[model samples]
Target: MAGRVKFGVVGLDEMLHGGLLRASICAIVGTYGTGKTMFALQFAYEGLNRGEKVIYISLEEREELLRATMAQKGWDAKVFDDRFSLLRLDPTDFNLAINSIKSELPALIRSTGATRVVIDPISLFEGLFTDESIQRQEMFGFIEMMRDEDCTLVLTSETDVRDQNGSKYGLVEYLADTVILLRYIRSPGLTEVHLALEVVKMRRSPHSREIKPFEIQEDGIMVYSEASLF
Candidate 1:
């Protein structure tokens, strides 16, 4: 049974109407400084907290940096070293990157017995495909292939530089079962920036559609689902 996979963010789960459906794919799309990586990490750590094995495949940040960020949030990797698998994929190498993700990731998931998997900044993976037609075809196939796995997948994507609310390659949002959009709203005077998120889409489940305020705190991301943006 595909159950609810809690994202570990406070009110974000409420917005998701409990959590993401297990064995489903979720895309978190946002521009720079929107905390896409933070959200992905929180999802991974949450799974660990729930006694489930997790695999984090990073296409951007190195493993050390990710671990340090988690360490700052008080997650002691050593405590769950056996349950966590963190690997860094060099996006610069097209063949190797494509081969590793498309060929090795599923096998690694099964070997690790991981129930939660994250590909932080999967936009890089999408970017590797230069041809739009090929990109769409490959991503659609990739997402479908992931559906057969027992683990839930979370993919972080950069917003199209031209369109703030859309995914970079414009494929992940279409292929994923759920899409969460993160945006930075500047105050009237442009004195400060506030982060807001919306449950853009969720299949097979009810979710809150309202855009809500959120903050990236020292411990983790806190979504103020009950608060009003206006």
Candidate 2:
């Protein structure tokens, strides 16, 4: 059996029958306040706890904000300073950011011997291409390049309220080996709002299809696999 990359979120790994397959690209699609960034952070932190190197490429937040967020969970960012690399790119400059990623990301991964990678909000990168065909081709090539590096990767994307099953660009889910969807659900009578997570698809792996409830606590994100959303 192939090794798995622990999701680092409580109860999430068990839902996948262990964790995400090693050397696979997973797409996490969610809307605002779905805790996408926190989930990515937990994955990286879990890798760090296992003594594995992790690289976080952020298209949205800065390094200081990331460190601060981790600190709130009692995780000292400095503990894994030597093994953690955080790259904050300017999403405004599409050409420059893409060029930097193409030219420098592989070298950074190689030099750091990183085993886990998180590209938060890959929607920004997708927005760079105006044409859908070109975007799909380039995104697939980028994913292949990352997979060739032999690392577990998680790419996050924004989804609309209507298109919950697909990502912002609509091509990321198709390219990823696994697709995890997060969304906000309203209870009967529209009285309560709950955060739900579902494993829409996972290649070569058996995963629970149930839409589970999750929370962003003081520590980190926690998924309730056994609990019913109702």
Candidate 3:
């Protein structure tokens, strides 16, 4: 159960003392253009490279856009599509999409034999339900379904830090096993956005409290040990 899952990001790995542990829900929260989706893509790519089956679930972008983003960064997205599988959740109706995701996820996990699964910006499913309690309960059910399948799940949440605690859409933080926050910190003249991948909580693993910085390159997101260039 412990070693069945692992995160590939370097700074994050250093932060968690060895990255995300198995069968856990890791949330990467950030605002727009903070490289949240890319990080999710990187996780799935890393898993596929490791000879592990991966499933990429997209809610924000269409399948073409996602593939193009990876292609722009010089990654052969088609290679992974051939090796693993990608499921695009572009529903004509938001409610329909959420319901489809809930209904199809378990079967997808079983059919693909996916060891690593990523749901890009899980917040997209938020609008499907208005009541906070109902939303939390539904999210908890979705998370439990994924966990019961023994897949390492990476769920991304869109956050606006100007608000309180960097969590706007209810108690998403409380539900995840580990929460990694990425923020754009503004300075006097220069605006420096740093990636603070925090292990808010890890069930039985020794987690790091230090907020580390990271950078996005042609390859993908990299966790930097040293101070990044501002």
Candidate 4:
């Protein structure tokens, strides 16, 4: 717990072998309704609970909605006013979005002395480039830039429409130090659908490779690490 950055999701942290390595990048790859934002919120709140400053940059959700979500989970974002910074970036505005993250993010991080940063659904950010090659290049540069900083970074990315296991832009998994894949698992005869998650890759740490069931509860996410799908 001292060296790792905990997601603070019940069983997911066990699957992550305590948590992510400090100062490393993690990618949460999943399709919509797979609790990607929920996981991001937990990661940010974990830092706040530790009396650490956190910066949550949401590209899809508005500031008020994010705060409302936290409120539903019984997390008082207002209480951590000085320590928690919830930023809503308009992904539709290309130049503003690009300039803000690429140029001002580091400065903001330093100014706030944040120890944890979360970017929910970084796919939109990747989409801004338009060209595949440019996107890859820009992401690589962005990752390197973050590496120079001291905080841990968590990026949530939407999976490709064709493949639920693949990231939308197909670049985050390669750039991030850890990649957690979330997807839907349908039982035989299509009677029931279960949500499952697995650690696809962890660069410098040992992690559970097994796929386990999880649920989005009223409070937050809970991964059934002890329960087996089989």
Candidate 5:
């Protein structure tokens, strides 16, 4: 955490008390269409623009498809290609993909000199192991690899359907330095997205205690200064 990485335009920097620190692992949990991918991808794009080497490890989508999605979100694939590295690894096949991730993560970091990384939809690997304990172990192992490489990691997880609460999968919340929850609140006939930033457990820094409202547009995710009543 020598040089803090600011998520500038998103207005999340203020919430984080200046942004996420280097060598820290953070989780972003949201349900489908809550803009989780957009948030994580935008962070990756931000890293590229900041002259920091980034590696986007995609799980649910292929590399090409991911690039296209970013393009539609107003990100230039060419610009991203020029500065950052992208590695797509889908764990739909479970053991094989997870093994590759465990084995190749360090090597990828070394090769790309990546200081920042985005593991989109990390919850995809939840079913890889039968036992809950084993699942936790695997996730911890992956996170450990990121820590060893001194990389700023952003992981995306799906909120449990049964329990609107954040914890359902493994000990992902326990292992992460920051836990961000994105949810859709339906009021009347309107549906809106809200972003909640919980320092959860910042190692040495202070963070916001409020769950702020964040809007996603062509420019990307932006947190509101204060809550507004409808």
Candidate 6:
């Protein structure tokens, strides 16, 4: 494995013992308002800062909306220009999106020599598959193909309210090389809600198992490695 890719989130790269392994797929799973998208954006932004070509594919939000969000964060989305590309695919047209991704993504990566890629809310795409078997097969293939590319990938997924695990489909956690879980934990009285992030799994890398507190600030997501859940 080559050098790890920094998450760009302050204090997070250290927890992973440097950063995410190169060309590996990491699944960022969380519920709504848990800052999953922010984490993904931070990863791409960090790549851009390092002069690495980056690509972001959003299945839930429009490109304009993402740009607006970036602008709110004081990041000039236009500054990166040609080095960064944000593509939004309609989740409603599942077949077309899946086909396009499989057929066109490789070419895009090759043409741009992108070194970082993010798939925001892959859960929506997985929901289109009615059969569990087919879902697993297709997901496995997709992950493998992404890994084959010379890029580090971050895929976001939604978690159910009742489920303890972070992924809605559950298969993404297994398919990905690393799994990062994010959730909102309420105090005993339900009066205080705290955001926590955990590295559930990181193949071939020794990562922190502790659940640490985090915050979604104007700049981006910040993980407190030294803090405890309580």
Q: Please give, for residues 51-73, the per-residue lDDT of candidate 5 as tens digits.
A: 88888888888888888888887
Clashing pairs in 2: none
Native-vs-model 2 lDDT?
0.90
- CA shift at 157, candidate 5, in angstroms? 0.2
Give the lDDT of residue 6 in candidate 4.
82
Error of 2 at 116 (Å): 0.3
Cα lDDT of model 6 by residue, 35-129, tens digit: 89999999998998898999999999899999999889888879998999899998889778988678899999999999999999889888878
The per-residue C-alpha lDDT of model 4 at residue 54 equals: 95
lDDT of 1: 0.92
Model 3, 45-119: lDDT tens digits are 788778888888787788888888878877786776655677777644776688778888788888878888888
At residue 18, what lDDT does model 4 achieve? 95
Q: What is the alpha-carbon lDDT for the whole of candidate 6?
A: 0.89
lDDT of 2 by residue, 1-230 (tens): 37888988998998888999998999999998899999999999999999999999999998999999999999987989999999899989987889867778889989999999999989988888888888888898898788779789899999954687789878889989899999989999999999999999999999999999999999988899999998
- Between prediction 3 and prediction 4, the one with superior TM-score is 4
Put down candidate 4 lDDT per residue, 72-95, tens digits, no spaces. Answer: 999999999999988999999999
Scored by Cα lDDT, where does model 3 land? 0.75
Candidate 6 ranges with C-alpha deviation above 4 Å: none
Q: Which stretches of candidate 1 lie over 4 Å from their true place?
A: none
Error of 1 at 149 (Å): 0.4
**Candidate 6 C-alpha error for residue 227, in Å:** 1.2
TM-score on alpha carbons, each prediction: 0.97, 0.97, 0.89, 0.98, 0.89, 0.97
Model 1, 124-229: lDDT tens per residue?
Answer: 9988988899988889888888988999999999999899989987888888999999999888888887999999999999999899999999999999999987
Instruction: Kindly give the stretch of ten consecutive residues in candidate 5 with the minimal lDDT sum.
Output: 192-201
- Comparing 1 and 5 by TM-score, which wins? 1
